[model samples]
Structures are given as C-alpha cells and as structure tokens.
Target: MKSSYTVENPDYQLSPKTGMTRSHYIELAKYLLEGAFQHIDSFDDILTFPLIDGKTYPQEDSPAWRFRSLEFEALERTFTLAAPLIHNDPETEIKGINLRDYYANLLYKALTPGNPNSLPMPEDLPDSTYQYTCEFGGLFKTLLLMPDTIWSVYTEEQKAAMVKTISAWGHHRTTQNNWRIFNITTLSFLKKQGYEIDDGLLLNHLQWVVSYHSGDGWYLEQTYNYYSISLFIVYTTIWNRGFGDEYYPEISKTIEKSAQKLMESIGNFFGRDGYINMWSRSICYRTWVSGAFPVAFMLENPNLLDGGWARRLCSGSLLQFVTKEEFFVNGIPSLGFYGQKDYMVQSYSCPASPFLMFLPFICLALPEDSPFWTETENDGFWEDLGDASTQTLLPSPGLMLVNHGKTGTSEIIPGKVYYDDPNYSKLTFNTHFPWEDQNPDGGTSMEYAFRSLDPRDLRGDDINFYLTGKTVDNDSELRAKFTHSQNMLFNGQRDGVLYRQAIMRQPPNNGVGYIIDLAEITLPGGVLRVDRTRLAFEYELTLGHFGLPHIDGVEATVEERKLADRTVMIARIPGRSLAFITYHGWDQAEAMTHDGNNAEADSSTVLFARKTAPKVNPKMEILITAMLHKMDDSEWTEEELSPVKDFTIQTFAPSGSPCGVQVNLSSGASHHVDYQNIDGLRTC
Candidate 1:
C-alpha cells in the first residue's frame, strides 16, 4: 500500500479510496475535543499554571497536573476546531483563522522542539517526579502532529526551543534505575518535530531501548513483573516516527517493522473482556493500552490494523478504564491498583501522560476524507470482549501471553523474600542475600531507583533500615504490621528455610524507605554461600580497578571468562554464610591513596563514577532444587533435601556471572555441581 498520509492528503483533498464520509471524521474530532476539555479542569498550578489564587505550595504539595494537560488540550483543540476552519473560510481566512494562531502561539509559548527559551522549569521543583518527564514527551507529541495551518503560526525560534528543552531533559537523572527508553522516544518525537539534537542522545536512547527489551512486542514495564510489558506502543511508535526520517532510514525501516509486531500484540491484550489487565505501577496510566494499539497502527501498515480491530480495541478499552474510576480527577492515570497510598496516589501522575491514550487519535490525523475516520467503533476488541477476562498481559521477546491469574496485591503479601533489585517502572523486583549488623555506612549509599515508562525516571530517597528476621515452623508466620507506619514483611516457607522481607516505612527523609530481603536456610552442616556477580543487558559494566569485593567469612578465587562473546566472573566461596557488597562513592567511605598512602580527595572518584549495567530482566521457567548432604557425597549419597519448588525469576545473569550461592563443603573438599540446559529457558 502507498503511504497512508499521502493517499489521504494529496493537495489536502480527501482520498476517494478510503471511503470515509465527512461526518465520520467530524465525530472523531469532536470526541477528542471533549477529552481535551475534560482534562482541562484538572490542570494544577505547579509547572504550567501558576497558582493564580496566590497561595504558595511546596513542590511535593503543589497542585498537580498543571499546564501539561492544558498544553496538549489546547493543541488538540486547536486542530480539531481548525480542520473545519480551512474549508469554512478561504479568503484571507488563513491569517484570520483563530484556531491556527491559537495552536501556533501555544506551541510557541508552551515550548516547541529545538527552542531553549520555550519555558523555564521551576527551580525548586523536583525533576524526579513524573510531572516534568512525562509532560515534555506528551506535549512533544501534540506539537509534532500539528497540521500545516497551525505550524505556519510559529517562529523557527519557538520550535527550536521546544526541541532543545526536550532533548536536554531526556538526560534528567532517572531514579536509581534508568527507565529512560520511554522518555528517549519522547525526545525522539521532539527530534521528529523538526529539531536538531545530539546524535549521541538519540543513539544512546536506541541502545538502551534495544537493551531493555525482553522480546517480541513487549519491553519490561520496568525490569521485573510477570514479565516486561511496558508502554511498548509509546516508545516504539515515537521512535518509529523519528526514525522515519531519511537521516536514519535503515533504523526507521527496522523500527517500522517493530511497530507492526507491536500492534499485532495489542490484539492479545483484549481477552473476552473489554479491558486489559492492570499490572505494574502507574496503574493510573491505563490508557497505555489504548495508546499502544493506535501507535502500533500508526507505525505499521494501516491494513495490518484494518482487519485486526486495532482502533476498536483502543477506543473501547480506554472508555472502560475511564468509566471504572481508575484514572485521577484531572484525567491523569493512577500509579497502580496496589502500592503505597502515597506512591500510587494519582497526584503523582501528569495529565499529558494519560493523553498518550490519544495515540489512537493519530488515526484521526488522517484526512476527514479517509476511510479510517469513517469506520464505526463497533466490533473492535473492546466491543466484542465487553469486559471479558481480567488477565495480566505479558508480551515477551517473541510472543505475548496473558496470565489468567489474579491481579497484583496492593495489600502487601506477608512473607520474607529477598529483592536483590526491584525495578518499578520496568516492573521487575528481585532479591538475593541478607547481611547482619553490616555497617550501615560501610557501603556506598544507594537509593530507591525507579522509572516510569513516562521517561522522567527518578532516584532519590533517604531512609534508615530496620531489618528483622526470625525462623518459623512454616513460611506462614512471617508478616509485618504498620499501624502508624508503612511496613512490609515477606512471608514464605519452602524446604527448611523460613523467609520474609520487609521495608519499614521511614519518616519522609530517611532516604531509606524500603528494605528487600532474601530468606534462605543454612541446613544442618549446610553453609549459606553468597553469589557476587555483575549482569548487563544493553550497556557495558565499568569495574574500577580499586574497588574489591567485600564478603564476610568467605575466601574467593575470582576468575573472569568469556561466554561466547559476553564476559562473566565466577567466584567460589567456602563458608557457612557469605555476604558480598558493592557500594558507590567507596573512596569517600574510607580515605585511600594510589600509593597506599592517604587517598587523594579525588581518589574516591572511581566509586562515584557513573557506571552502566545490563538489565537482565529476562524471564524463565525453571525447577530449582536445594539439597543438604554429607561432606563427601560426590557420586551417590543420601542427604537431607528441601522439597523441590517451582519459582519464576529473572533468570539470566550476565553470561558467566556467579549464580550467587552459599555452600558448605566438607572442611576442604569442593562440592561438584551438575545442571541441565533446558530449552526455552532464557538463552545467552
């Protein structure tokens, strides 16, 4: 098929081929206008709208959902009302057109791509919040899609300012974890808005996106979950939009194909129900489901969307989520169905981000004359399913699967399980070992690093840690209580180990708000061994020559090897319990010098140098067995064993990374290990 944009708009005439009646196009424009207006009232006074009422508010306490939504609404409204303007007034009407000038001025004043002076971000505001990151991307899309009449109103300077601000904002520090792909596409969309930006950021964005992808049409909502199924449509569509430019034609083609696969996956999100499963944080941002379908359709061939009921799926699903009270008052989405009331609070979300659901509306960008606009909304995924099954949609590297299981419990499950690393934005949480009386300040300090698919990934929280552990007969007894505080206790009993993990809610400034623990048992004569390994996905890991592993009561023989092309490090430990710790800003932890003298003030630099790691949030199904044996059972011996249990974890560490295990071998004899390579498990 020919390019849809052209077929629909040759000399701005409606295409005869699409068979769309003018009335159909008008209806869509009207619906979008209503959406824009509905969210208009939700605008807060923090960033875009000043507290006109003249009340000062702290950044955290400021009225949320400010100008972000207003900007997008104005832009969309400008076009919705303007498409009819051109036909209504043809004589000198161009300059007199109110909607065109309104949109252009909004683009100019609100900020357009490539312009630095667009709007100044407030100094006291915390960029870590979703407001800053999500709005930029959302607004960028609205500006990118402006029609020619609206485009004609802005000065080159205004557009440039919008582009510049968005590009630079792309590098804003993500929470400890960088879920930047979502924002990078926002940056890419700005680039597509006709701005010149650094190729490095674009390349970096692509590298990270390609790296974090779990497979198929799905990317990790963040890093962990049933699997990685984030704002796939947003990132893919925006990237495809920018990649379409000739500057990177090859990448554009590849991304276009990727976009197609993404749309096909959207078809699966619909079960017998009109709704998609709610998973991960930002449950408030439910329109992501609708937005994904439209974007997939936009990037892929419309024909692909034609038979698959792409538009219907988005329209119906969006309508359902909104009617269900899942979204906030301003029409911004909710963080999730479950999570800290404060964390999942709708106030944390921005209105523009939710308008991402308008992605399907892009199909409206089709000329009023196109068949796409004329099609009835009936018979789509939402219509037929009509609230079928509430299933978790898990899109992987090559396939998409839905779990008929229950939704994630916002009510914390009482049990102690280790969270080695928990990524909220990408939606993956994991755990490894436990340290007892470990120096609180001995290790480099880290924060609650998380990312929202929205892009402004944030990472900063300072709270203290209070860890409590106990052995119970079964995993059933490990739980937590927070009558006056936010507390979490992991509870689970498997084999001989009773395990629980807890995050004691700290006063707002402790920076240490959550604690993740791994519950393990040291069987009689069984030593708990800790595995110290580094894993990477999209980026390379930088190891400072000075930092060394800190393990309690364990001797290590560390060796590095290549697994095919990737590198891995293995360290065998002979001890009952082992703890491996790595910290940031270690040089500051203790004074040191290169010559073994007082380390120069800058010597601590290695510890603080920004380093990257692979996001191995890959999913696998495996049967893990733990057995306790006599020191000398190499061949055939009888030993106590824990009942085998099935668990699903992000199983791929960097190739060759130690499996992180603690073991006790007879005083000096090393225990031999055997394992099977199962097909369909996460492969190297």
Candidate 2:
C-alpha cells in the first residue's frame, strides 16, 4: 500500500473537509499512474493487466469479443494520469517514464492503423460499435483540455493519422444512449481542427441528446447510473464550452439550464463526509462517483458550489478509495469498487476499468487562482441542516436520495427495476453499506425475496424483476419509441418521506402483475420502510435490513423484543447495530451471514423479516421499520425505534378491508396513501 509518490504536507486550512489540496492531487495522480507506468515497457505495448478473477471472455478473438475495446480502455483511461500532469507541469515524470513524452508517443502509436494497441475501426468490428467509439472521448478530451502537453507536441503527420482514425467513426448504428455525445464530441473536435464532417448530423445528434436532460438534474442513461454526472454532464459541458452555442443555441440554452440546475443539487447527493450516493452500476470507477465535481468547477457562473466545495468533494472522493489498501490489487485500483468484490464485477470490466475513474483529476487543468483552488472548503448542507436528513426527490429517473446528518452516509431509493442484478434493483442503497453481491438466496441487504410457488427455492429478480426500464425523459418523443420491461409509475416525496409506486409483472406469468408502493421516512439511525403490498395471491415475502459489516470477529448479539403491538428484532456489534421491527404484518425474523460478497468487509450479517401469511387478503399493508446505525447515539432508545407514534387508517369497508390509509409519525411527519388511482398510474 506504500505509494511511490506521496503528498508531503497537509493543508487543513485550505481543505477542512478532507485535507487534500493541489499537491495531494498531483502526487495522487502520480501514485495512481505509477501502477500502469510500471507495467508499460514502451509506448507500443497495450495498457492492460490480469483480471482479478483471472477469467476470460467467452468470445475472445472473435468479432463479438470486446478484447480490443478492453485494450482501448487501458490506453485511454491511463491517459487521464498524464493529461493533467503534463498540462499542469510538462516535465512530469513517473517511474522513470517522461509522462508527456510517453503519452504523446502513445497517442501516435494507438491512432496509427497498424499499431498493436491501436483501436479497431467501426468497419473492422461492425457488431460492437461501443468498442469502436467509446474511448475516443477520453482521447480527445485530454487533447482538447491540454493541447500543449500531448496534441501540440505531435507532428502534423501524427495528428493527421489520428484524425483519420477518429474521422473513420463518422456515424453508425449503436445503442441510443451516450454514444450520441461521444460521436458529437469527436465531430466537434474534428470541426475545430478545420476538418470536414456532416454538420447536419452533428446538429441532429446534439438536438437528440439534449432531450436526455432530466429536468430535475440528471441526464438519463440506459443503466441510470453515475455516468449521468461523470459522462453525460461532463461531455455535455465540455461540448457546450467548445461548440454548443454556435451549432444549436436553442438546444444549448436548455442544456445550460439543466446543467446549472444539476450543479445546484449535485453536491447534495454527496454526504458531508464526501462519499457520493453510490447507487448504480460500474462501481469499479470508484471515485468517479464524484466525477461531476471537476466539471462543476470547470463550468462558468451558475455552476454553483457555494464556497470551494468542489475541492472538498474531489479530495474526499480520492481518499475514500485510494487510501484503502484493499482498493488496489498488486498496485492498480481494483476492478471492483471498494476492494476485489466479485459481486460488483461485471463481465465487461477489466483491470483498466477502474482507470476511467481518473476523470476527476481533470481539476488539475484549472488555474491556481480559480475559486476551485483558492477558496477555503466548507460543508454546504451539513453545516446548515443540523441533526436532520434531506430527502431530494428526482422524478425524471425515479431516484430519491436521503442525506443523513449524523451517519455521514446517503441512502438512495430508486424506482427503476433490474431483476438481473441487485445493483440496480435494490429498494435502497446506502453509501456506507453498498449492495451485497452474488447473493444466491435473493435475500440481500435492502432488497426483497419471495418464496417460489413450487416451494423448492427462494425466487428473486430472475422470476419477477424487470429486464430493462427507463424514465420518459430518456426518449425524445417525451415518451420513447420502444417498450421497456418496467417503468416508474410515480416518484414523489411527501413530507420528508420519499415514495416510489411501481408495478411488476411476473415474467413467467405476465398476466399476474402486482402493484407495490415503497415509502420511507428518515430516522436518526436509518430510514423506516412503509411498504404497500397488493398481490393477486398470497406469497411468502422476506425483507432485509442494511447488511452490517461483521467487524473483528465480534459476535453480534441478536434479540427479539415483543411489545404489545409489534415485535422488534435487534442485532448489534460494538460499533454498529441493525434492527428490524415488523409493525403491521405477521412475520418471522432471522439473520443471514455472507462472505466474499460484500465490498466493505469479508463477511456481513443481514437481518431479515419474513411474512409467512397475511390472512389471505389481497389488499394488505406491510410496515417493516429497520435501522442500521453507527452509535451516533449512545444506545437504542425505546422511543427511536417507534418513530411512528401514531398511524391512522381511514376508509374502512364492512368487509374489514381498508380502502385508503394515512400515516402520522411521532417525528411530526405524515403521508396520505390511497389506492383510488392505482389502476390509472402511467408506465413508460
């Protein structure tokens, strides 16, 4: 874990939140780049390393194989190290390699037609357009951001050859996602260089991608992940600073407004401690979770980080990952998020996958006197809101984030459903406790499981989760042309409580769709879950509390307290405690232990509550309150567990079924939920 380069002195005055400064960033860049630099024998060698699992793609060397693209990931991502270093100080060197000279030589070698590491053209691999064009943005952005370092040093012939390779990706069929930005950025760079491209096509793509701006702040992607900030907003801001106004000013206006709005609330998503609400995929790009900070600082006025907040985030985000010895395997950042967690790894990820995270270092390209550097860091909302949580509802993507004041962690409630993986499908994702991987029983933290009708096994997303989903903002028509397996019927916040109403059709039994409403109100320790279940038939249901990372072999104590009205299940270790109270429905409680599945620890204990039956009523209310805490409080108070001092149910039927309901919590929070319009809910 010893770094080859180290930040010498601490700057607590400049950065109170994280103690990271300009020097820290430089040394950190050198430290990270050293991993790749050590493995590089010369500029001609491809930038890649062994996958942590030591597995190979099933289609290696075939046209479908993404091996070439994986190699490109290595080359373009490592450029992030040299990009700012060479620009900020051209004499930069790491591990005896002249950073500027090496990257300059690399640019030429990788762009020329015959180099081993050179990216394959679109025509060469017609099936995988993502491979042909995905990395060009990283390549061109470095050139554009600091021309003197790499691009300016190149000979005219070297530049021309690179352009030929760049220009060869004129336009082609691909997933209707971020590639629009990639294509547009490439075209904009070419046009800036006085090369000819289809202006109409560029404008068309420009207008098309602008529609992806979710009015609240996010630019939606297929996965609806962190790329919204790191890739979508970053590339959009870059293009706008370069060519947006000249090409299509009207669309540029809309883009600017969304970007500005994004800057306003983007930082709120990050905890006071600076950990981003890590709710979605590609967690391998660890620190890039806050990758939007650099772009916000790079932008002009209305980019809105109150006072030198970007540096606080940048520094904290970098430390959150790099400081962890487990974050690196051998030397490079691991292919997984926190450590070498197999659950977080996807087939597409490689050792270089984490390299894409280097985008945050682009802050190094900024001038010293810029506000991002000179001003003292401040904790924006954490300083303002004392002991309270902030629940920001983003309707465009059905994402609701609750920033806890005491825990210094963020919990996200997402509306979209991805049955294939808990990464996206989980009802809740906590910053401190991330999603558990490779859970065979489907009883993962912050997720649900239903016993199979066959009674042979536990069933999860594979049987019931949506194959794909998206919000309406993702499509240009105000509604997309294609159909998604699932959709967000409604996403809204009522009185500090974030709620998402969604319906899922059993994939095997398409006619057997069910409506479920997920709602939660924040607590000092954890948020309380109030779920409305409406199934056509009775099914055994199980819910899990946030998985507590088992620490230092300390055995957790499990106890069940049965009060007059409800039973609370408590499990606690020294530093942390996890409790589950099944308030409304009938249930049994237990704990599941896991190993090698969590990124934060070697093993974890996830407490679960099960509803064996609920009187055979199709209309049932299930209230399971769970709290996972880090002793911000000395001990669990009796009053804290019962946040809901009162719950008033209305509209009782003679058949003993409640037609509608209302909730009044002891914390002075309330919610009015009704099934009156449940059938009328909209779907994408």
Q: Which candidate is the best by lDDT?
A: 2
Model 1 TM-score?
Answer: 0.46
How would you encode candidate 2's per-residue C-alpha lDDT over 472-497 as one tens digit per residue? 22222312121112334455565555
Q: What lDDT is reached at residue 599 by model 1? A: 12
TM-scores across all candidates?
0.46, 0.88
RMSD of each: 20.2, 6.6
At residue 57, candidate 1 shows an lDDT of: 18
Q: Report residue 316 deviation for candidate 1 (angstroms).
A: 1.6
The regions of model 1 sitting more than 4 angstroms off are 1-100, 112-118, 121-131, 143-149, 157-196, 224-231, 299-302, 305-308, 321-343, 351-353, 367-684
Q: Which ten residues in a row have the lowest lDDT in candidate 2?
A: 475-484
Q: Tell me the RMSD of model 1 versus the true structure.
A: 20.2
lDDT of each: 0.34, 0.67
